[model samples]
Target: MPSQKLSTLEKVGFGAGDMALNVVISSMMLLITFFYTDIYGLKTTDLALLFVLVKVVGAIADLVMGQLTDRYTSKGGRYRPYLLWLAVPYGISVFFVFTTPDWQYSAKLIWAYSTYILMTVMTAGVGIPYISLVSALTNDPKERLSANGYRLFFAKIGAFMVTIIVPILAQKWGDGNPAVGYQAAMAVMAAMGIGLFLFCNFTTTERVVHVVEKQSLLAQLKVLLRNDQWLILCGVCVTGTVGYVVRGSVAIYYAKYYLGGDTETVAAFLSTGVIAAILSMVASTWITKFYCKVKLFRYTQIAVAAISAVIYFTVKPGDMALAFILYFLLSFVVDLHAPVFWSAIAETIDYGQVKTGKRVSGFAFGGISVCQKAGMAVAGGLVGILLSYFNYQPNLEQTQFALTGIALMFSVIPGFFHLVMGMLMFKYRISDDYYTEVKVQMRDSGYIAG
Candidate 1:
């Protein structure tokens, strides 16, 4: 079971596609809730519920796509075909995601719900299998680490650039009106979606194949669920996933309420946060090599929590400058953990195999994907429902209570989740030694590697 070979170009291509996917999808989530509440006239509760429903759909898509891609066999490999077939649909849904309409609120809700759900479902279908394919592409653990590091690096760039420019797109597209900004953001988002699809099409290729292609979904799930390592990692994955969601969802209100900044300034603040997040990629790359991925994850997340604590108490009106800097630091923590999480996933794949005496990377990671989305859906829904609970008014300034909630959302909620994830990571057993040992055993046991 010596490693199968491929040209270096193929490796770069696959990694590039992963970067493209992360950037566009994450940026859309980062911005879309604001779009619904402000630009598109969707109520907070409605939009949140819509996203929750979409998350459910997306989860199913991941599970099904996992099974399909596991069985996938094409010249391009199991993953490439989905990247090809789903490309158009991915772009099309995203285009419509931001598109505005003349329809009534009910009609608009229908349209928005359908489109968002479609985007999430299609995205998960493409994304999970694509991600799971990483191990198959190269069994060299460090190469997988390098692949994830490179992908996260570009993803931050994409996220940073998107954050910086998205509001500008909104302004230019919306022509100074929130309503128009909604329409314009959708168009821009759609364009990014196309870029994502085409980039993957041109850049990536799968190397190794899923030999257990005929394994039934039930069989896969049973084994996947039985793996203790997968269960342990899921804790960190789900908690941290909620940490990201709460921070992202609350940013709009944090800027609007805590800093009392105008929309443009808030967007700028977020752009700055993205800048901080970008730098974390480099830091994470080196940190992963020296410290255990799980350990670094705990340290960084705790650091994020500490930063959030600073913001929660220190933020004051007319202190916008100070708050922005505080958030930039918090964003650094957010960015720092980005690579740690993915690399952790790669390790968990090995962890699962070693523990179960079977390999089901697709199912294990797919389950994690589902957990992440579920956390997000819950957090986003809670954010929305809570925004409405506190009587958040988009057109006007928030009430004192609403403002408190916003601050807490960004500070306490995410802070708490990060702490929980840290504790969870402590229980995780995967180490570089464990991962390398697992790989040695697998390769010896006739597992194919490319």
Candidate 2:
């Protein structure tokens, strides 16, 4: 068997990859909608089309990147090379997405579409390989879990930066022009993203290289479809992501309009949620040592749904203190499933191999990415439609209808999806004990090295 242990430095390095990734992800979830509407001057209908089209393209890019990863291996390893090669491009794409050109409305829309799509493609280039790198790091499930814990912890740090730093910096830098401020602030973030990706590339090593079979994409997909556990994870990904994206997208609106907060208050509100998520990463790591990870995943999400309902019913507009407290609790509980969910992807791959006798790696990782994109698409569409329905007007006092819709988006509407996500986890069976058996079987059968 390959070495099951990862050094602290190596774990930190792996974590850095996700941190870099979250610079984009956190922005997409938290700031993109607000940026488009309030700062960038996109109409709700245009924003809806932009989100849907970009995600559709992103899904396709994920599949293509997956196939590319499976077909190629080099001195840099199967996944790390992408980080090195795409880091600059990825950073540039991020900068461009936030850059607002002084052009006509149609021209600006085209630019938005072009830059967003490019960023998504670049994300796929790095993202698929980064995720699949987990399987390559080690076959030991416990090590995978620990590494993922670190990964998620750092990912939250990256998100925290986006929430706390971006708005503050943008306001300061732009002075009078919010657009200029956003561009400058994101430029700093983009540079950090590139550096972190390079650090990840240099510090991590891949030990468990699978002997992948040569199969058509269609054939590999067929195999994956048959793996019920993986399918369940995909469903969980889609539903959970929808909830996450919806809540994140509306948080700024909730703070600004619903809570009657200014820029600093909005920043503080978003930072509170992210800080709670950061703590949840550590808490999940500790809790899983004794409690069943699967149970933790299920119950915390269920708790999130209940907390969300409480926030929706109890916290009226301008109830800043209650809103912050409930939001913190909701954020903490909702993310308890994250490390478990990521680590479970590697386990489900192993389970799929043992049951079907075919090793499917890249496409499986890619499929999860696709499911996440699909969730974002659904969430984005909903946000766009709901904003229009609520008669939301940018940078103004919202009508009661608009404020209520924003509140619902932040709480109840997304909570329903988390509820379904928790319920779906009930069918997932790959506990640590079960995964240990799958490992033994794979090794004994020579599907993996003995």
lDDT of each: 0.73, 0.95
TM-score of candidate 2 to 2 decimals: 0.99
Model 1 scores a C-alpha lDDT of: 0.73
| Tens-digit per-residue lDDT, 84-193, candidate 1 | 77767776776777777889989999998887887787788678867776766766666677677677766766676666667777777666675667556656655665
RMSD of 1: 2.2
Q: Candidate 2's residue-wise lDDT over 1-450, tens digit each?
A: 654899999999999999999999999999999999999999999999899999999999999999999999999899999999999999999999999999999999999999999999999999999999988888878889999999999999999999999999999999999999999999999999999999999999988878789789989999999999999999999999999999999999999999999999999999999999999999999999999999999998899899999999999999999999999999999998899999999889889999999988889999999999999999999999999999999999899999989999999999999999999999998888888889888888787752
Residue pairs in candidate 2 whose N, alpha carbon or C atoms collide under 3 angstroms: none
Model 1 Cα shift for residue 173 (angstroms): 2.6
| Winning candidate number (lDDT) | 2
Per-prediction TM-score: 0.93, 0.99
Top candidate, metric TM-score: 2
Model 2, residue 110: C-alpha shift (Å): 0.3
Candidate 1's displacement at residue 446, Å, is 1.2
